[model samples]
Target: MNLLRTLAAISSMTMVSRITGLLRDTLFARAFGASPYTDAFYIAFRLPNLLRRLFGEGAFSQAFVPILAEYKNQKGEEATRSLVDHVATTLVWATVVVSVLGIVAAPLILMGIASGLDGDGFDKGVVMTRLMFPYIACMSFVVLAGAVLNTWREFKIPAFTPVLWNLSSIFFSLFLVQYFEVPIYSMAVAVMVGGVAQVAIQIPALKRIGMLPRLSFNPLSGLKDPGVRRILKKMGPAVFAVSAAQISLLINTNYASNMGGGAVSVLQYADRLMEFPTGILGVALGTILLPSLSKANADGDIGEYSALLDWGLRLTFLLALPAAVGLAALSTPLIAALFNYGEFNAANVAAATAPLMSYAAGLLGIILVKILAPAFYARQDIRTPVRIAIGVLIATQAMNLVFVQMLGMGVAGLALSIGLGACLNALFLYTGLRRRSIYTPHAGWLGFFLKVVVAVVLMGLAAWFSQAQLDWAGLRSHPVLRIVALLAIIALSAIVYFAVLFALGFRPRDFMRRAK
Candidate 1:
């Protein structure tokens, strides 16, 4: 496979997903703004989202995919299909139990995460949490199908299916708000609908691949499958790895909740902005690399395995650095143009900008984590990342103490802590890979770094100049002009970045590689 072309395909589909997600956030900000109610809803949404990451795409995918790949590569078609069916049955049963428990324990969970929430906010959070709890089940199934599809090298469907969820949320944010007694409940409704839509869209694709899982009616039916046992054993550490990261987020949300009414909402706004590049670049590369990496490992081809990691790292820096620079340099305009409307005003935009810049500061590190960690996961070495994650969790909380409590940087401190921790995590993962001699840097890295640095510096300057040309929040009455100006600034900055790279002897083909 041409990895560059495959990466582009997945990234393009992911870009569409991110674009719609931004639109959904934009609409949400306009309709709701930053409020206790919005905070309530965000807090409510975080649990199911945490589960989606933990059980769906995070731990489960890390553990399941490589094993599924092994089944396909070593055990042949019938065995691989059997593995899928058993895994599907096991995952469904597990998801159902977690969903029921989450629903029943909604209030306790809310209190555990956001103890500082007001009585009314707490009540609303509980209701929304209950409403969205089952979303985990839908998303679990979605991720299960997505993993199967990605392992089959059918990347388009998995990448495109997320757009369905974003559209569902956008629809609810647009048309359903007025019907709810508490308008934020509409978002909870959107989550469930979107989850189902995501799952529904992948069914035919799975069938076409002949990997459609025939789920057992009885939960115990798949418990004894050898492949399922292997997955479960791997998931033990994988769960801890994902859980450690979620615990840090839970701690941050708790801190944000106590900070004030709008704290969680603003951090969420900044996070949505950060997700744009991470999804397009980090997620796109990670999604494609894992299956390929696992294939190399399964074939016992050490050279191909190391080369794949090198390719992903080089591509990550090539793309992620400029994105980070653009975000930091144009934080105000980006936040203002996209979110400063109706309920979300100048102050909210300003509030969100600090965290966005902090997030941008570590954007490369954040994305690097995506690239480097998969080196271990593809080898089915989940323990290494889990240990690193646990240690990073501890270090992050320590930084939070100094940055948030001691320094009183508030939401920005929380974000900065996470960013720096990600850098620390990525650094450790890199050192581990080097120590194990799993990855060796290819020649021309020095030249590549220099070219990227010069190009990124130029792009950053362009972004700075563009942001200075607009009173982003002041032009709220001229929404069309504000949006057009933002788009032009982004376009011109991108042109300057890529143009500089081309002049510096960087070409698309220089970075392209074949997986086989």
Candidate 2:
């Protein structure tokens, strides 16, 4: 598929998922607020999410997809199918053992991560963490299956799988909150169900594609498979690289947990908002480009690979730049519109807005890393990124300690630390790419970037004026009016930015053209 068309498909589905996720968080904030229970719940929820990013989606998908694509390209479909079955069986057995251990040792894990919570709150956190721990095992398998489908160019099912999680969470949060009383724990149950549903939804798609992986205990089969072994080798370091990022966030969360009752929830909500754009634009581009880059590399078409990388980077920056600007400009209004209801008060909105703005600062960096890291992974040079990622992780922890303890900046400090780390990671990766001459932008790229920056600035100004008008009109008191105003600001910003870019020598048709 063409890059723009693929991105459109992925982004449309991801946008729906993100919107539903926002609704899920909206219900969660109203029902649970930022109480100790909610704090504990976020910690518990983050554990599975961390594992999903580290082992399942982030590392495994990055490592698996390129290799699987190459296998299909080289040895035909049946050989790739065998490799998938072997990897699937091996992954299932390993995940089952890990899940058992996780359930058994939940308290120790919870205490280690969230030792700040006391009394029944601490106990409940452990209980919730344990209840949701099995989700990691289940979702990891789902992600593996999804990776297989993505390798086969079946992106729709995998992209839509997250919708199940969001919808399930929203349903349970709305209905079960009143009946269950402990809505946070109820959400945990919903998460487990969602994970199962996420996996189940992909089965028919896989079967229809005639590539449903079967069970196979032959370790030698996978280990001996060149494609599988190649991915395994790359995965070892890529896991560390992915874990470095997640571990940094985990450290931030741990610090945020100790800050206050609501700090964790504030960070969580702000992060959810930031992830909306990142998932829709950055992740969609990365997912599409990985296979394309891999195919280019496999064919020794370095020019095509570089063109794809440059195009991906340009599109990522174009999309994420305005999102970051808008978020930073309208953090308070956006937070209030989405979250200022039920138990979520104005003070809570203020707390969340600060971190949202801080995260917005590194939005480009975040998306750049998402774009660039795949370039390295597509080249099967995962170790270099891992090395750089370790440095980034250490820097993140140090910055967090300095910001949180020395400066007393709370969750916003943690957000700043993450942003700083992402900036450093992107710079290091870009520098490495330059050293290898693997990626070089065209001369006109700088002019394109400048035009984008100008356009984003115009969008920011428009959004600011719109937000000020809404505030002056006192619409913030009415949730419906406030939400409508925020959506309008978003819509206007997008329209103005695109119009400015198109007027400033950026052709919409040029973006639609195929890479190289």
Score candidate 2 by lDDT: 0.84
- Give the TM-score (vs. native) of candidate 1: 0.99
C-alpha root-mean-square deviation, candidate 2: 1.8
TM-score of every model?
A: 0.99, 0.96
True lDDT of residue 140, candidate 1: 88
- Give the top-scoring candidate (lDDT): 1
Q: All models: lDDT? A: 0.90, 0.84
What residue pairs are clashing in model 1? none
**Which segments of candidate 1 are over 4 A away from where they belong?**
242-244
Q: Write the per-residue lDDT of candidate 1 for residues 1-516, one digit (tens) a residue.
A: 899999999999999999999999999999999999999999999988998898878889999989999999999999999989999999998989999999999989998999889789999999999999998899888899989999889999999998988899899888888898888888999988998888889889998999888999999989889889989988888876655646677789999999888899999999989989999999999999999999999999999999999899999998999999998998998899889998998899999999999999888888898888888989999889999998999999999999999998999999998888889989999999999999999898898899899999989998898789778889999989988988998899899999998887777888789988
Which stretches of candidate 2 lie above 4 Å from their native place? 217-227, 472-477
